[model samples]
Target: MPIIKLSVSERRRLQVFITCLLLAMAAWVLTTLSGAYHFTIKQVINFKNAPQRRAFKALQSDSVEVTMLGTGWQMLFSKVNTYNTPITVDLHTLEHSNYIALNTQIAQLNKTTDAKHRIVAFTPDTLYFDFTNRVVKKVKVEPVLDIKYQQQYEESGKIQVKPSYITINGPGNVIQNIKTWKTDTLRLTNVNDVVSTTLPLQPAKEGNISIYPKSVQLRIPVEEFTEKTLRIPVKLINNPHYYNVKVIPQYVSITFTVPLSRYTEVDEDFFEATADFSLWEQGYSVLPVNITRIPAYCRIVKTAPRNVDFLVRK
Candidate 1:
């Protein structure tokens, strides 16, 4: 290969030309970067400094737009870093105004991000809020649950909640409309025994509200049912002193349904069937056998010997 070389005088001239070209390029880049540009960014509005007796709610939304002017370098950083910092809207400073004056807030944001950037205009220009007195209400807390039981099994008792009610404090309008706080939905399937768990209460629709209790304990009693038969004696009670009375059937068969867990605990001893002489005044030769007492867990189906013949001796 053959190479062409330049003399010192020719090389010196070419070097100066190249240097000039590089200087012009650098100057243009700096001029363009230092120029001003407009940018629009969305910023979240954070409410703070609320007094104990007062509550605040934005009429439109919790966030707003922030339009500003900045140099190319500042704009580049803002784009990469996103909105500088969330605008902290002080509730205490909020007063009667068509739109919230964000001059102070935007200035702070600019100081933190880059003082070279200036806030020109807010897209919304302003903000409005509904301020109301803080009010508290006591509302019942109900557990939300979906449960499935095995065949022949059912809830034996009422669902029990540890804390029956909760106290909620918030804006008067919101608190007044609320009646009850519901727990997060709970689900249980194929349950044959008691079910117990703790569930968190659902959050309020309004973000500014406060709830005293956020959780509660729930209990559900479940039991399986079984048919049972208890043979109870029919006693002759309230007999006249001069006469002796005897019922034809000494015992009566009491058939009923009982919970499987309590089936063994229940027997004829837990039941009482009696034939009263007072019924004789109704002009009936036979006396009706009445079940005077039965276990609370038992459901009567049918009884044998509904009526019994009475023998009276004087």
Candidate 2:
């Protein structure tokens, strides 16, 4: 076949048509990519929002660090923990900067996906921590003795106790500079029997940790006693009707032994000690005599020697 020669005008028209087709194809490819491809981002992560609940004790910050990681789309910006949650670091667990960096990286991975967002940035590759030894402090002693006793019983002796205070051990930062510890308010009324107990100690300031000894032992001495006396009542038996009865001695002396504390309650000496002779008639008779109505601790050892003679006449 023979080649045909093209004019300038025709060549220009063909070039314009081809250029337009190429432009349309490029636009179609771009649109397809925008709808089909899903990309992730990185964002900042807040260490504070990590914890869900309030930890009982204060945490150390020296060894802790925060880092955020996410899908390429998610890591685009910094991430914040919820408004109420607080993030804390354990000083004891912090050995080096790697500890802080490791924790931060873990926090980043916590996001929905492994991809890091574009807006997030991790800096200060490492963290520093400081530490010191823990210590114990002295606290005041509390007494828990009951002073109220039962009826007719009283405390008549002295009270004594051993070491009144104890020591507590805890973290140096928390224990240092503390002068003393004290127990809560205590009151005991109307206690008479032996009373002994221990009391718990509380820290004056927050964040102070203590362990080992929570309370101290307490001791109290008590006793019961009665008073002594020397007053005895008289008893009378056998009396004669026919003849006048003659007794050698009218009254007999008496004494008793009791606790000194109760000496005042037992001191009266007026009792009748007569023997009835109505049972026998016409002849002399003998009767037995005894003592009654004495204190709980008192005893009668002896009585004076005396005799009563009974006579009967027509």
Candidate 3:
């Protein structure tokens, strides 16, 4: 191993030679990538222009492997980006035949694609579908809600959906099992007033099912509640013997919460307090007073004198 030092001119020549080699390698790569080539990529399939008179279900998956003819640069980019735009296939051809040949649709499918990257072929080559009788039916819409109301606030009345029912069209076998459709979740927090908004229906799980009017109007009545107390008479129940039974405390004070708008409309007549005499035979000394009925929108706070002494006379 002897140390050898090169002259200044020799070192300069070596540097120039190395630079030229690197430049040639770079030029070769660029030229190769610029040339046209065929490549394969997976693309999602979207069906359009469906036949009007028939319902169809695809026999295969929603995606297909597509062979594309494009420049090497496009192939390089396609490798780096895994997402390929979906190819739309017209189903109007199904009116005559149950199968669609992808090769026949190359021109139509390329309309939305870049001219530089044309569709050469599809892996499946053809698409098949199963047909069934088309049917239309009206189904109720159920709203999904997640709401938090402020203290002393609540819904005053039933929630109203502008179009309570929606029309769905699909294969009779599929539509027969679907009784109702649901809307997307409507979320609200710290709500103290009326809620009115439009919500879109949840998308159909089956691609063949179509819903009319994608959205619906929703109205929820809300109001502030206030406490109200009323003295309601306790009536005896289950006295088949027709014996005279008198409760020691004839009237019980019932306290409940009612919306402000309906405060004046509610009274003792809207409540029914009863004491079951059948408990006497069950070894109870007193009868338990229960609020048997109350308005739908009202919430009971407390019923005074939960138990009452009763007198039985023959």
Cα-based TM-score, every candidate: 0.52, 0.29, 0.87
Candidate 3 lDDT, tens digit per residue, 44-116?
A: 8888888878888999999999998888889988886543877888888888899999999899778867788
lDDT for residue 69 in candidate 2, whole number 0-100? 30
* Stronger candidate by TM-score (1 vs 2): 1
Model 1 lDDT at residue 65: 74
Indicate the residue-level lDDT of 58 in model 2: 33
Show where candidate 1 strays beyond 4 Å.
Answer: 1-49, 68-103, 106-122, 227-258, 264-314
* Model 1, position 140: C-alpha lDDT score: 96
Q: Rank candidates by lDDT, best first.
A: 3, 1, 2
TM-score ranking from best candidate downward: 3, 1, 2
TM-score of 3: 0.87
For residues 1-314, what per-residue lDDT tens digits would candidate 2 score against the true structure? 53967789988988999999999998876555434222322222233321112212333332223343333223222333221123333333343322344344444344533333211333444443333455656654544443566554454434433356566555566666556555543456666666666655544344335433556555555445543334333444444344554443444555444445556655664233454555445343643334555544454555443334434444
Question: How well does candidate 2 match the true structure in TM-score terms?
Answer: 0.29
Error of 2 at 86 (Å): 12
What are the lDDT figures for the candidates, one per model? 0.79, 0.45, 0.91
